[model samples]
Target: MFQKILIANRGEIALRILRAAKELGIATVAVHSTADAEAMHVKLADESVCIGPPAARDSYLNIPALLTACEITGADAIHPGYGFLSENARFADILAEHKIAFIGPKADHIRIMGDKIEAKRTAKALGIPCVPGSEGGITDDEEALQVAEKIGYPVLVKAASGGGGRGMKVARTKADLSDALAMARTEAKAAFGDDAVYLEKYLEKPRHIEIQVLGDGKGNAIHLGERDCSIQRRHQKLWEEGPSPALDDRQREDIGEIVAAAMRKLGYIGVGTVEFLYENGQFFFIEMNTRIQVEHPVTEMITGIDLVNEQIKIAAGLPLTIQQSDVRLSGHAIECRVNAENPENFRPSPGRISYYHPPGGLGVRVDSAVYQGYLIPPNYDSLVGKLVVHGRTRSEALMRLRRALDEFVIDGIETTLPLFRVLVRNADMQNGDYDIHWLEHFLADGGMSAQ
Candidate 1:
């Protein structure tokens, strides 16, 4: 096991890694930007270092400074708790050159899976189901039109290097395809410095489900289970739950085995997620996240597995202690992301929090880095905290989440708490008949009426 590890990120996830390291008797070093000089993770870590200014390019995303911090602190491994450089293949290679373990997958695996075009190819080669689209990136509008016609209408044009819904456009007609392609290419070039874009058949109202897989360096891998992240806004997940409500027992086992086999075949290690879009009784691969997800706590709550500890152990040349059969899903879990934003306009509301209280009870967990009197800076993500609750069934979990949201309080700033309160009471959500467009429609239709 590594004696020390450096966390290369910020916010609640950074704090989460620190706590996990402490439990495993591993020292933690936190890297923060000038904006986060007094962040909660910095206070809890055994050591803290200032990397750069508030801008992500100079701070959290700066790879050289992170490597230097590791050298200065004598840390043997670096744990990127999502976002920033967590999925950067170059960063992984740099750590490998320095003989410092990158507590994730190999650089080659990252490189292969980071590009949407290559990931699709790899998934197809592994016999994993994928959405029908162009064989590779489209070189021009003509090729895009041809591919769109072949794939049928309602196709999506996506940047090869995109995530977070950036550089993506949906075209439902031939006339829209050319314009969408041009715009997506421009956005991809500006955002990712790559003009490459690919076309894929888009499934309207699909349920966004993902399987969590853990692997050892020795080619052994198993899936913890699946999470239904269909509750989202503009491609950002809002509410997530374990043992996806959409999957039957046979479907779950089938997808789980395929995902585990793909990971093992690719020599993937540590923790990762294989995302898919399910609609019309079929599943299609979307992309793979090379690090822990924000909604991972829901999976942990149901499985009772410490994913962070497992990542560290895998990096230290230890095989996974648990097998597929050993993994068991006990109950339904839900996570609602509470962000510091206006519930009406959905704009960032950064200010000093005058009053703060997190709900707590049996099977309720709160992951946050803010407190009363703490000023939410405008230089970072608007997320203030996450309220996660677990129960014996989905309906029971919904009831618990409603109660927990009512108990949560934050003053001096508008938040999405009200939004969740309204969501939990919606009939579509209550019956599990909601689709990806449900939230957008609900919000656009002036929200739900008072019951």
Candidate 2:
């Protein structure tokens, strides 16, 4: 086991990694910027180091500063909790060159999966079904048109280098194909420094589903199940649930087995998510996330498996302790991301929190770093907290989430709580009949009659 691990991120995920390491009797070093000196993770860590200023570019994303922190702390491993440098293949390679283990997949795997175009090819080669589209990057307008026509209308022009819904443009008809291709290329170059873009047949009513898997990098692996991340806005997932209402036990089991077999064949290590777009009972694989996802809490709730801990163990050269037969999904779980934003306009709202109270009870877990009097700096992502709930059934979980949301209080700042309160009462959300576009359409149609 690693004696000391340095967490190279911030917010709830940093705190999450710290706790998991501590539970395993491993010391943790929390690296933070000046704005996060008073952050909960820093205070709770065995030691702390100020990496840089408030700007993420100079702080959290600063590679040299993080390596220096690890050197000073004599940490043996780095756990990049989800975002920031988590998926940076160069960063992982550098750490490995310095004899420091990265608590994730190998640098080679990260490099392969980091590129959206290559990831699709790799997944398809592994026998995973993919959305019909281009064979590779489209170099010009002619290629783009050919791909669009072959794939039929309603194609998505997307960046080959990065994701997070950026560098993407959709065209529903042949007339719009050229504009989408140009726009996507421009955005891809500006956002990811890569002008490479590809085309794909876009599903109109696809559900965003992802399978969670853990591996030892030595041919052993297992799948935890699937998460329904269909409730999203502008491609950002707001709410997530485990044991997707869209799939029955047979479908879930079959998909889980396929994912596990693929991971085992590829020798994929640590924790990773295989995301997909589902429509009409058919799943078309999307690009896989090379690191832990933001919605991992819901998976943990149902499987009772500590994914972070498993990642650490795998990085420490340990084999998976549980097998596919040992795995079992017990209940339903849901997670609502509480962001510091206006409920109506969804504008960032970063300011001092006058009052705060997180709901507490059985089957409820709140992951956050905010507290009363804490000032939320506008230098980072707007996510301030995550409220996760679990129950024996989906109905019970939904009710628990509603009650928890009512109890959660963060005064002096706008949050998405109001929007969630309204969403929970919607018929589509209640019956789990929503797709990726459902949230946007609901918002357009007046979210809640009272909102």
The digit string of per-residue lDDT tens for model 1 on 1-451 reads 9999999988889988999999999999999999898789998899999999999999899988998999899999999889888999999998999999998998988998999999999999987899999999999888888888888999999999968888899999999998999899899899999989999998988999899999996879999889999988899999888878778888999999999999888888999999999998788999999999999999999999989889888989998889899998999999999999998678999999999999999989999988888888899889898999999999899999999999999999999999899889888888888778878887778883432
Per-residue alpha-carbon lDDT of candidate 2 for residues 1-451, written as tens digits (9 for 90 to 100): 9999999999999999999999999999999999999998998999999999999999999999999999999999999988799999999999989999999999989998888889999998888889999999998888888888788989998899988788889999989988898888889899899989888999999999999999998889899999999999989999999999999998898888888898998999999999999999888888888788889999999999999989999999999988998889999999999999998779999999999999999999998988899889999999999999999999999999889999999999999999988887778888999999998888887775556
Q: For candidate 1, which ten residues in a row score worst on lDDT?
A: 442-451
- Clashes per model (N, Cα, C within 3 A): 0, 0
Best by lDDT: 2
Local error of candidate 2 at residue 201 (angstroms): 0.3
The true-structure Cα RMSD of candidate 1 reads 1.2
Each model's TM-score? 0.98, 0.99
Steric clash count of candidate 1:
0
